[model samples]
Structures are given as structure tokens and as C-alpha cells.
Target: MMGERILPGSYFQYPPPGFPSVSPHRPSSIPTDLERVYIRGKGSVKDSVKEEKLKDKPGFEHLNEPLHVLVEAELPKDVINSRLDYVVAILENLLKPVDESLDNYKKQQLRELALLNGTLREESPRMSPTMSPSMSPFNGTGMKRANYFSQKPLI
Candidate 1:
């Protein structure tokens, strides 16, 4: 949770990394179908806005499995046992990533990375889909692209 800034459209594991390794949520117990998630937060389960958020619902969406994310400030033992799936861990990854400000250069770097990783939709294709993977854009020399981008700060 402390290494680098979580940029827009970047995928990260919840409870990012400074917390102790021995967490109650070890990523396996989470339910594949999140419809059974029970949230302890204020407000009804489905508000008008929630339905819209569900269209682009957050999760490993490429796999076609939508997850129901439950938010609870404090986990109640009785509530845990009542749900179809159990709460693996009690975590509160605050909205700090959304609030952080980034410079134009950093923003561009994130954009480029997103494009390379296919996270962000590309405005234009540099190469056609028909292009073979073996063929290099520059030449077929098998030269490795220099990557200077690192999420961790160099000390």
C-alpha cells in the first residue's frame, strides 16, 4: 500500500502493501459471484446510482465474473455467519488514491503504461491487428524495448 501512487485505471490488490503479511483476507476465500455480499454501510443496497456503477463494476472483469463488494467499518460476528460467504478480512482501504494529485508528466507516464498494458482504450492503433507478433515495427532484430518506468521510487 506504500510503494507507489495508484494511478487511474491501474489494477491493484486491495490492502495494497504496508500491512502485515498475515492478513485475515488472503485473497482465496472471496466469493466468485459477489451477489451474496452483505454490506454494513449506511444506505440501501441498490440506489439509482449504484445500478449505473454496476455497468462498469470494478473487478477482474475480463474473466466475466462480476463481484459484489461489501463495505463494513466493523465486522459483526453474527453478520459474518449469516452471509453465504464469509468476510475473509476486515479492511478499510481509504479513498486516498483518488485524492492524490499528479503532475502532467506523471499522468502521461501512467497513460502510456495503460496503453501498453491494454487497460486504457487506445484512441488510435499504431499497428494494424493483422500485423504478426514476430514482425518488429522497427526491424526484426529482436531488440528489447528499454523500460525506465518503475512503480517504486529509486533511492
Candidate 2:
């Protein structure tokens, strides 16, 4: 029930580039996924997937798979992404000065998970000066460079 259509060929696709290929009607033509499936073939992603599984080895058939979008498609008016909801909780935990017994460690673990999952990234410490170079100066990082030969001041 999302307002926008997600994938191609659930309905007719309006690909301007592919129009040239499928324009002239043919008498003896078979629809291919690339050419016709994207143009005229109206098939649900779920049905296509179900057909694929039938060709799989016996006992390898998928049971009770969660198909996010397609065949037997009946979605409610509202959908909430639980992962995104959890992300809000993660941000709150990371931001607030939580001092409970395991709170700090829990936040640390959450931060690591967010970073590794590519859900979030560390913002640059020195935010771009709001005003200007002349009006306001940048808060340069204080991380001192370490080296065997010599040391360079970070800021």
C-alpha cells in the first residue's frame, strides 16, 4: 500500500530507452525477462520466486519465507521498519550519559554494531565553521601524530 511502486514489470514499465526494442509488434515472439518482462509482462515477484523454487532439489523448497513485496500481496495501511525503530533507540543510548552497570558497555556494543553494519558513521570532529573562515575559525582536531622519525602537531 506504499504510494510508490518498488520494482519494474509489476505493471507496465515506461523505460524510454527500451521502448525502441519492444515497439514493433511481432507474430511469433516469446517474452524474455530483460525485454518483455520489463515492458509488458505483469508478474508478481513472489510468483516468479515460487516458480524458481519448484525447480530446486526436492526437500530444498523454502517454507514460510517472508516475502517483503509480492504474490498474495495484501499489505496494511501502515508499515513500521523494526530495524529503523531500533536505530532510534541505539542513537538515544549512544547520546545520553548512561551510567548504569552495563549501560556504557551496551551503548559501546550498539555503537560498534551501528558502525560495522554501515547504518551510521562517525561525523568529522571538526564541524565546518558555521559563519566563515574570516568570521569564525575551525576547531582543529587535537589528535597528535605519532611517528618514529618525527612528530607533527595535529592542530
Candidate 3:
């Protein structure tokens, strides 16, 4: 009895159903494609910086100056104004359709609301306090009652 093993009863029915097995070949380290690209880009940037440093040495000083000077050249005020006007026109053209559609949508919604209001009014006619005496507890009676807390004591 010392060596004998006690087996627990099976919880599932006989001929148990098989489940889909998980893949055994999982990667040891998850590789991120973006991280790899970023690292590669970082290395290229470092190399470019090193190249720029090499070009900045004593013999290559004159080569560092920009080939063209843009600050001295000035465009006419009319040309700048024309460009600004063109940009504004393009923006207006892009927004015109959207504005029209929004206006039309608002009009349609107002019409729908008006129709709904008309239907609701027709379904239940407006009733005055005089028309339904049973519904209103105070039917236009101006009589006032003394407040319980503010009542005067008998002398």
C-alpha cells in the first residue's frame, strides 16, 4: 500500500474532446521592426555627423560656406500679396462646399423638427387649466394658507 498510487476520478466524459494545440516555436526575443529601423537610422546619422566634422577641419573651411546668398535678394510686395491672395482663394474654394452642405443639413434638420412638432401637437392638443379641472389641484383659486412654522400663538 505504500508504493500504490491513488488515481483521482476523471472530471471530463469518456473520449474527451481534443483542443487546438498552441505553436511550440516561440521566438526567444521579440524583434521590433521599428526599433531595428531606428537603430539603423541612428548609425547613419552618426556617420553623417562624423563626415561633417571631417569636412570642418582647417583645409576644408572655405567649402563649408553656403554656395548661394538668399537674404540680399528681395521679392516685390505685389508678388507676395498675389501669393497670399492665391492661397486664400484656394482655401475658400475648399471650404465653400463644406459650408453649403452644413447650411443645407441645418435647414433639413429644422424642417424635420417642425414636422415632428406639428405631429406631436396634433397627437396631443394643448389643454388649459380650466379645460381639465380634475388634473389641477389649485384651479385658479387665489386663497392662501398660513405657514405652519410661522403661525401666531393664541393669546
> How accurate locally is residue 54 in candidate 2, as Cα lDDT from 0 to 100?
55
Candidate 3 at residue 150, lDDT? 84
Ranking by lDDT: 1, 2, 3
TM-score of 2: 0.18
- What are the per-residue Cα lDDT tens digits for candidate 2 across 42-91? 23233667656553546433223322121122234453233233333433
Whole-model lDDT per candidate: 0.36, 0.35, 0.33
Clashes of 2: 0
Pairs that clash in candidate 3: none
Clashing pairs in 2: none
Question: Which residues of candidate 1, in runs, are more than 4 Å off?
Answer: 1-35, 45-91, 94-96, 99-122, 127-155
TM-score of model 1 relative to the true fold? 0.18
- Candidate 1, pairs of clashing residues: 1-16, 1-17, 34-68
Task: Work out the TM-score per prediction.
Answer: 0.18, 0.18, 0.15
Candidate 1 C-alpha lDDT tens digits along 59-121? 423223232234232334454343323332322222123322533333555576677677986
Candidate closest to the true structure, highest lDDT? 1
Pitting candidate 2 against candidate 3, the one with the higher TM-score is 2
Q: Score candidate 3 by TM-score against the native.
A: 0.15
Model 2 residue 2 lDDT?
Answer: 24
